[model samples]
Every structure is written in structure tokens, then in C-alpha cells.
Target: MGTQAPSDYSSSAPSKMDEQPEKQAKIDEKLQRQKEIDDWLPITSSRNAKWWYSAFHNVTAMVGAGVLSLPFAMSNLGWGPGIVILILSWVITLFTLWQMVEMHEIVPGKRFDRYHELGQHAFGEKLGLWIVVPQQLICEVGVDIVYMVTGGKSLQKVHKIVRKDEKDSIKLSYFIMIFASAHFVLAHLPNFNSISGVSLAAAVMSLSYSTIAWTASVHKGVQADVDYGYLAHSTSGTVFNFFSALGDVAFAYAGHNVVLEIQATIPSTPGNPSKKPMWRGVVMAYIVVALCYFPVALIGYYTFGNKVEDNILISLEKPEWLIIMANMFVVVHVIGSYQLYAMPVFDMIETVLVKKLNFRPTTTLRFISRNLYVAFTMFVGITFPFFGGLLGFFGGFAFSPTTYFLPCIMWLAIKKPRKFSLSWIVNWICITLGLMLMILSPIGGLRSIIIQAKNYKFYN
Candidate 1:
């Protein structure tokens, strides 16, 4: 009987070959739907921003509390190396950022809006996600956590100046809570364009306070006994400090993390590619970056030298009104920065909840998720407000790849420049530098954190 006839399996059930196509079609349909859902995300929802939006958004993203630390970083590096690192970082990071902008719309009529999406394109879907998401989340969330500490400290600085006797009356933990509270409201603003006003204000405030930081240092003049020597007493400590300082420089130029997202906001077309206006905005932002960084770094170190506080504002104690105002500006600027970074993470979380976890998309979900994120960052900030150490650690460990080398790698992979070509050589050089930064800097940063943690108490 077995030899008599072959079973008509196609009649009983579709053959495996047929099932394959059916499964593939279902997968394609699901992907198409998910793409539609992605459009509603905060990063992609509103694409009506002008070029200036990119300018301030990049400014708000790039210039943060990191600027205040530059002079301190300079103290770690000294005159020659500090100036060289800062300049190279400016040039190299700007190059990497430009590569990111150009890559945003590399494929025809398609935009890699999120950093991970671009990663997916370059490294294959699964590999790209693996490569980029951790780095990106680390960078974004790290910045948010740092901002929490920054905002709280800045607010406390204002309070200290305003109410000299009652400075310790309000706890820093409470101030951080207060800083996180604003995000609970502003996080609901629904997309990048919606928060443009806040970003604009933040951009202005970043410049304002940065001006105050360096100018105040200038007004104070160089310290009477300023020592341009390394802060750490030991050789190993100084080496580590140099590594950590490199991380600080890397962290300072970290606007690249959100460059693709910012570019996503600008409207793109064949003739009028988003890159043109995006580049214009980026150029302007970097100019602001140079203005903010160079003086604060050079003069701040010259003024206070190794004694300069991690936050320059903390060192500027006199001229009560100006210090108070600058600290307030930092508070406002951090408010904008926190939201700018958190927006991308919100999109990711909402995506996972709605798409992966089968949760319905609702305003309540947005509210709850955003609040939890703000709270988590606030807690971390209040617990370990080791600002410089955190920057150095996360800056090199996470930001180095994304900000410094990741873009170049993607460019080399996708563009496939000829060997020894200018593009090829440049990208390789960046990759080498970035890898060194990643490997060496975090060691220093972690050492610093451990040293700081020994003296730190939670919620103090």
C-alpha cells in the first residue's frame, strides 16, 4: 500500500514551500504596519521644523553642564595637550557628525531617523540593534542622569547664593526631585517640534550660562597661586586623569548622538536634501560650541587651574546676582536638554510597550512611562552625583563609539571607500582614536568614581 501511491499532502495541507511564502507575507504586513506606527513616534511625528530648529536643538544637545567641566578637564590635561585634545575633538566630532547627517538619507527616499535604525541598516537588522541600542541608551540615559545632578546642583547654587544662611536648608535630593518634576509636565509635550520653544530657550540659556562661566572666570582673573599641574598626586592617577579628561572632551562633543534624529525633523527632498539645512544648523551649533568651549576651558583653567570645581559655576561664588542668574540659566538649559534626550528614549519605550509587549498606545501609558524614567534618573543622580567621573566613565565607554567612531564605521561599511583613499584613511584614523578613547578612558573614569564614591553618601 505504501508503494501504491504518493500521499496528496497538498490537498490535506499546504506544502512547506507554500507555507514559507505565506509566513513571509505575514511578516511583511506586520513590518509595514509597524512602520506606520513608527510615524506617530515623537522623533518622526512632526517633520515641520525649520533649519534653526536643528541649530538650537543641536546646541541644546551639545552644550550642557559638560562645558563647565572643560576648564577642570584642562587642569587635568595642562596647556598643550588640553588645547590639542579640545581642538581635535572639535574637528573630528564635527566630521563624524557630518557623516551622520549625510548618512541619514543614504538610501533613496528612506530616512534612518533613529540611531539604531541607521545601525540596523549598516550592520544588518539584528546585529545593528545589538550594536547601537546599548550604546545609544547609555549615552542618552547617561546624559539625563547627569542632567539631573546638574540641574539640582545648579539650583542649589542659586539657592546658596540667594539665601546664604539657608543654603543647606533644602537638600540636593529635593532639588533633583524638583528638577525631575518639570519633565513630568514637559515630557508630555508630544514630539520634537512641540518642544521647540523650550529647546530654543534652553539653547539661549546654554550660551548665556556658558558665557557667565568663562566671563566670570575672566573677571576673577587667574588665581593668585594657580598651579597648572595635574590634580592627582600619583603618576598612575595623572595618567588615569588624562584618560578621563579625554572622555570629558568626547562627552562635550556628544551632539552626534542625536544628529540623525535632529535631521529627521527637517523636511527632506531630492533637490532640497535635509542635509543642506541640517549642515547649516550643525555648523552654527559647532560655532557656538567653539565659543562656549574654548574660553571656558582655556580661561577657566588659567583662572582656577587644578582647584577649579567640576562645575565652574560652583567655583564662581562672588557676584551673587550673576552667579545666581547663571545657575538659574543652567537649570533652564538642563530642563530643555533633559527633555530633548528623553524624547528619543520615550519613543523607544513606547515602541516596545505598544509593539512588542502588546500594550495599547495611550496617553496614560506615556504619562506613566515618562514619569518612571524621570524618577529613575533622579534617583541615580541624587545617589551618585559624581559628575566628572560619570562623564568620563560614560563619555568614553558609551559616547566614544557613538559620537566619535561609530559613524565613521558605518560610513566605511556602507560607503565602502577605496583602500587608502582620503575617506577611508580618515574613517580608520577616527576608528583607531575612538577605540583608544573607549578602552583607556573608562578605566580612569571608573577609578575616579570609586575614589569619589568613598566620600559620597546616598541622597546627601
Candidate 2:
């Protein structure tokens, strides 16, 4: 048999041995595959693909702006009514987020562009442009004021920390310059991947200080006996008081646009669609923010109870360490707010200098814009010692779109008016109510302003 096989092997005709090259090639391919398997043996799939980002977006949005406004709110309604308002705001905010979550996922690219263009798609070009133009301007600019006023306050704290006497000399020009410049620098750079750590840090500090302050106040038994019982009994109670609370809630809960901005910055993928990322992040951010804000309000109410000032800084009777930390945290919180505020300032300048006038946006524009913003900020800070009016004004008019109106419109645009979709209806109610409240908040704000005027009558 061996000899026969050998004979066949030597024969000129093809034999089984002729298949060796092909077989060997197949074996070689198998070996290469095995080698690749071996090389990739330690490769592990990511358990938390978006873990950091989710946490970051959620925490930062909550801590940054929410903490900035909570204490002031606490002073207005007392802990009981303030907490109720915060809860109501969260409800509306959640409703909006539920609608937005679906829209964000269905079409993920160019969110701002798409959102702006929706009116043309759903209503018509005229309506689309009309809706977008005002909303964009208001949302951006209104948000800008939030950052400016709050950031100016924080910066003033820093300045006060360094210069005790210079407190009176807090120039709007300087404050605007600082934040505008900060925004200019940060806005030009790539977005940072991790904002949660800083956000959480701020949250912890804000909560800790407010919590401690409230606890101490409770221990001190400084209950503010504010008699707003007439508010509930008045003919204008529902229109003014209820609506005002709702508007304040709306203001405190604003900032969904920042979520849209985040959605635009990320790379699009079917798996990483923006619906979950954008909407969930916002809802969570608001919830965390509401929770944080409620506590500050409740505790601040309980602590200072009725004696709370617009800038809750006035209510503390703690050690210097606590005051210093609270003040520092306020500064950090303002810095975070400044990031959002700068967007409007930037857009305004760009519209005037570049978009309208056909000039280029350069470092110089950045500098000029920021300087102008800082100037405005300082003016607001100095003139409006009471934080309540600033919050109310911004919240009533500016934040309405971000909090109540836009999301409803956005949902209507994306999902076509389905039976389950009541956002637009709800938002319309909120808007109608908000418009009413806007009328009255200014009344309350005017009341606040008048009180401030009286308090500063000596200055005049």
C-alpha cells in the first residue's frame, strides 16, 4: 500500500497529495483566526458606555443653576408654599421631558437647527420663524441674565472676601467683563466631557450649607410669622398667588435648552440617540435640582424662616468657615450659571456685529461682548440687592419658553398631535397661566422693589 501510494505521489497525474497547498492554506487561515482570538482574549465590553456623561449632565444641570436660585425662593413663599411650588414645577417639567424624550430620539442630528425649523414643518414658515426667533432670543438672553446676575453676585462675594470696603464699589462693568470673558474663553474650546464631578461637589456643598443653616435656625427657633393668609383669601388669590407660584416654579425649573445644546455637541449614533440622553438627562437634572432647591427653600425658610433676603447669604449665623464655604460655593455655582448665560451674550453680539453687520467674530468681539455683559451684571447686582425680583423677572418672562412653552411646541412638532400628547395643551395652560402670573409677579416684584426702595431710602 505504501509503495502504491508512493507511486501515485510520483505520478504526473494529479493525486490527493496535490490538495496539500490548498489544505495548508486553509490551516494557516484557521491558525491566524485562533491567534486573533488569543490576542483579543482580555478585551472587555464597557459596562458603562455613558455612565460618566449621564451622571455629569444630570448633576451639573441640577447643581449649577438650581442651587443659585433656591434660597431666594425659600424666602418668598415660606417652606410650605415654596415646596409646593417646587413640586408643581417638577410636575410640569416632567411632562415636558416625557414629550421631549421621544422627539430627541426620533431625529437626533442638528437639534437646535431642527427645533428652530419645526414651526415651518408643522405650522408653516411664518409660524416657525416667529416661534423660533422669539424663543431663541428669549431663552438665550433670559438665561444669559440668570448667569449674569447670579454670577455677578458670586463674584461680588469673592471680591467682598478680598476687599471688605469695596463691596459698595461692585461695578457692573467689572462683573460683566469677567463672566463674558470667561464665557468667551470656554465657549471657543471643545466641550468638556466631565461636568458631573464639579456639579456634584457644588451640590453637596450647597445642600450641606443650606441644610446646616436651616437646622441651626430651627434649633434657634427663628420662625418667620409671615401672614400671607390674605393671599389665599383675596379675590385675586388664584390668579395672582397661585399663578405667581406656578411662574416661580417655572423659573426655578428652567434650563432644558442646555440639554438641547448638549445633544447637538455629541456624536450621533442610533444606539446613542438623543432622546434618552437629552430628555432623561434633563428630567433627572431637574429632579435633582428641585430636590436641592426645595431643601434650601425649606431649610432657609425654617432657618431664616420669614426673614430671608434675596441672596440667602444674609440669613446665615454660622461660623466663618461655613460662611466662607457657602460664599465660595455661591461663586462656583455662579460660574456654572455664567457658562449658560454667556451663550445669549455671545449670540446678541454676533447678531449685531457679525450676522447683521457682516463682521467676523474674533477674540476682540469676545472681549467686548464679555466686558459689556459684566458691566450690565454689576449694575443689576448693585441696584437689585434683593435677589427675589431678579429671579421673578427672569423666571416669569424669560424662563417660560424653556420651562413650559417650547417643549410643548417641540412635542407637537415632532409627534403630530396624538391623543396621548397633551403637552401643548398643558403648556398652553401653563403659558396662559404664566402670562397671567407674569402680570402679577411684577406686582410682587414691584412690591419687592418698593420694599427695597424703602430700605434704601437713606441712599436716595
Clashes of each: 0, 10
Per-residue lDDT over 1-460 for candidate 2, one digit per residue giving the tens place of the 0 to 100 score: 8679878767856667787888899999979755543232111101122433544454554454444446555544555666766676667666765655455445445343234444455567788767665666665555555565566555656666556685376664466556555554445421233333444454455455455544554565655564323233456533343433444455666555455444543445666664555555565565556556666666665555434555566456455456666666666655555544344344445555754665554556656765666556545544554455555655666566655656676666566665555544665676565456455565554444465567563212
Off by over 4 Å in 2: 1-81, 105-110, 113-122, 154-247, 344-386, 419-439, 450-460
Superpose all Cα atoms of candidate 1 onto the true structure and report the RMSD in Å to 1 decimal. Answer: 4.1
lDDT per residue (tens digit) for residues 1-460 in model 1: 6753456654678778989999999999999877767676788888888899999999999999899889888988889999999998999999999999999999999999999999999999999999999999999999999999999988877877777786357888999988888988898988999999999999999999999988898899888988988978989889999999888888888888788888889998899999999999999999999999998899889899899987888899878889999999999999999899988899899889888897866788888998898889988999998989999999899999999899999999999999999999999999999999999989988988999999787877
Residue 220 in candidate 1 has what lDDT?
A: 90
Residue pairs in clash, model 2:
172-375, 172-378, 172-379, 173-375, 175-374, 176-373, 176-374, 177-374, 180-370, 301-305
TM-scores of the candidates are 0.93, 0.69
Q: After superposition, how far is residue 417 of candidate 2 from its true place, in Å?
A: 2.9
